[model samples]
Target: MPRAVRPDRSINAEDYQHAPRPVAAMPKDYAPGEEIAPHSHRRAQLLYAVSGVMRITAEEMPAGQAAARPKGIWIVPPQRAVWIPSGCEHEVRMVGPVQMRTLYVEPDAAPGLPAQCRVIEVSGLLRELILALMDEPLDYAPDSRGAAVARLLLQELVAVEALPLHLPQPRDVRLQAVCRQIEARIGEELPLEDIARDAGMSSRTLARLFRRETGIGFQQWRQQARLAEALARLAAGQPVGIVATDLGYAGTAAFTAMFRRSLGTTPSRYFETRAPSPAARGRSR
Candidate 1:
């Protein structure tokens, strides 16, 4: 295929969404506490964080449904990316100074991609592929180096594993209200009975609704919510003691234990490691 004209790299995503290419990579930086307002994309997106963390909230609409419901919250740390399907309404909040490298893939260009939003692990090879593609022309020739990288990127994505860094939200208005309150008072130890009463439902009914709508029980959902918050705070360079205390953990040890149980690592160690270094990337290539 002949090369198409490339848009200005400094512009927003709207500039590249209509490009005549299977995949286009863009680099953007965000300051801590910056927020991208709610929006939708015509092409699917692989939002990768080279550093820092991103807290993304997306709305998922069932097939043939007119209205969309909150899917869940995903906490994306370094060396990880979130796959957002085409036309999915989503918003992002930066947990730290984020160096984001994103790829927008045409819907028909990549088959077998996930239909739902998910946080996926970005392997060393995939990371390098994304970085390399960022330096290529937007409309690279089909037989060019950029095209080769794009093909491998799509192949890697097909086999990428989804992470458990999601906190599912409920569809019911009453449950949504309860979830919002829980998120707001994440540091508080609110009793199930009191929360249910405030929502105008019995504890048993509230628990059932949580399980039915979110595929997780109330306590599990609460724990997941806490975990999501902790990841953001920790990624922002907060001390373990402070994050633990702010999130209602009794002590640093308890918080560390919880982090280990959920993510298989301590908070300090998780943020200590980052995307592969330049030397490592060279070796991989």
Candidate 2:
């Protein structure tokens, strides 16, 4: 299903381009089904969801990026942020009621960060820094204490591990067909050859193209897709057994194991631990 766009006016590059300082933070609150139309930014963005879930869909990513780089529609759970590199076209939608706190960083300021988008784990200290910096002016002086905080935020971003909540999107028509098929019947494990045949290609050819376009093997990609679906359903308070069964797992244990392996936590535990705190509630300036 196509994601619902936000009824509010869309935010775009001009909103932050030529920011006076290296980093600028803004706060935004979104209702469920709210969305931003396709847009890009000159500055890289750390799209942090403080109170709710969001789904981000990118236009085709730039070339030569690795698998570790996130692509496609990313599910932003609480306490997590999606790092969008400079100049990448993407759209955003809030899955539930969302408190969005975004930090826009100049591309040149963060040298060691990922060139492509990925979901980064937000540490407690980093989260505090983001909140504190929200009060800082975009043109805050570089040598000021506020600038020091921004510097610390940059240090925190370096090599931050990516969460596997992103679903890789393939651009090729054949691979798009295969991915759509998997998403439509996500409850069943379609054989590789069958998927390939439906895409009008041999199994080997499909396998190669899938990885080339999406940065992971077909199996792993499908698994990620399932996990992504599982996240939205699980967040809706669906029962574990139902979610597991709906995602094509034979039983709850099988599904639980996959969830744990993929995210280092079980379904029940992930939701329990990730509830938003009140401090995350902030308004757009």
Candidate 3:
């Protein structure tokens, strides 16, 4: 995969607060598999995808200490944005042809927001606000309509709830080992005992560590990892059967049941509904 191309010096988060403009937006189109190398911003960011999925991995910290931050993965679909605190190192990969619209907020302007990286809902008002703000120059007059829009956008960001969809990274060497195995062969069948043994820990010991580190049992953590992986494969147009079999389900039927249980939608409808369907796009073409 190639990296994204951007002109001008990269800006940091704090600069947004002192600039003539307190908010900024940069719109771009990305091909599938395109990535941005690990980097950090001086300004906080709201990464909103107008039409595709973005796989974001930021440093995550343990449980309630997400505010402390270590690393986590956010599978951002349309109508959603990932809020990243200023100065957090992260990377992004486009899962499909992504029409991305990102908002960079001044931390001083939007205080009390999540300190860690996580997904936030993009409401209709917020969506239009982003479009409107994108048109203003970085130094727009503070008293102008653009300024009002910027302030309101900050307010809306504060009220939204964080989605419980991000995959938190485990820090312990033993816990990390099990997570790597689950992702390496997401669909392959492997007993927990076997996975624990590979990590040089008994099954019970590993399970305890998972709960302590990630705040979830081993099974739940693995399922979310599989879901995150499934989103990537499905967004890239993998077949339902292939994904199901790859994830370790018995068949398409069983795989879908777990998918629906985990994500609340069937695999066939998940990515398609996030954007226009092929048939719908065909008619437009």
Candidate 4:
């Protein structure tokens, strides 16, 4: 099967070009089906999906000039939101109709929050408090109760440990070609011969490298990539048939069966279980 294709808005280099100072909020309401672009800000951010589900991918940039980095993280859930520290580059993809409420805080405030990347649970009360904070206006008095509530909300954000579902795309010349081909033709079934040719190696050599670098065989690694894509596409509310076709699956049932095998639940139920808190629902407007 091929990888899945999602309907994210095209992103440009300039989006991740400029960096802002660590501080507070950005007044932007992401639409149900939109891409937040690949960008990094001065302040660390807590990307909470107030309503619906969202897919987030984050990684560290190379030491110098770069296209895209190696290691990657894929996040999809309402109860769970990714912690992006200041200066770390990241991208956002909305799955379904997501009401994303991002709390961008200064570096000084970082001490109170998670020091590393993690998924924080947005409990009911905490969710309400965050939505209320968003409505209090950016210029709310420093000594106001609203500010206190906001501080409390930040403190209440408990980090949830999870398996590191990140894949490290190596910097080897052979691996680069294979990675690019896979990304470019996400909707096409990748043939072993083509991948081996692109990598400038025999099929046997390529398979060995995949296992060594990625800890999985070429086929398994591709499936993981496809699953990551599927999670992103399905979270965006794409039809199963459309997603299946995009991933080069034989049919929707085949794609669904694969999804079920990888994940414990079906796509619809998986998304349904990720519904945002009531406060998230209130902030949907």
- Global lDDT scores for all candidate models: 0.83, 0.79, 0.73, 0.62
Instruction: Residues 1-285, candidate 2: write the lDDT tens digits.
Output: 322222232244476677788888776787888889887887888998776787899744543354443448788877788988887878898887777888888888977977767887788888888877765666779788779999999999885888988787877867778888899999998899888777788999999988888878989988998988888787767899999988889999999999999999888877775533344544342
* Candidate 1 TM-score to native: 0.88
Candidate 1, superposed: residue stretches over 4 Å from native: 1-8, 62-68, 275-285
Can you list the residue pairs that collide in candidate 2? 6-35
Any idea what lDDT model 1 has? 0.83
lDDT computed for candidate 2 = 0.79
Structural similarity to truth (TM-score) of each candidate: 0.88, 0.85, 0.80, 0.63
How would you encode candidate 3's per-residue C-alpha lDDT over 1-285 as one tens digit per residue? 322323331334344545566687665667778998888776678888777689998876323444665577888876578888777789999887776766776667667767778887677677778766765667778798879988898888888887657888777877777778788888776898999889998999888888888888878888888888877777667898988888888889998898888667787765554432221121100
Give the number of colliding residue pairs in candidate 3: 13
Q: Which candidate leads the pack in TM-score?
A: 1
Superposing all C-alpha atoms, what RMSD in Å does each candidate have to the true structure?
5.1, 5.8, 6.0, 8.4
Worst lDDT 10-window in candidate 1: 276-285
Stronger candidate by TM-score (2 vs 3): 2
Count of clashing pairs, candidate 1: 0
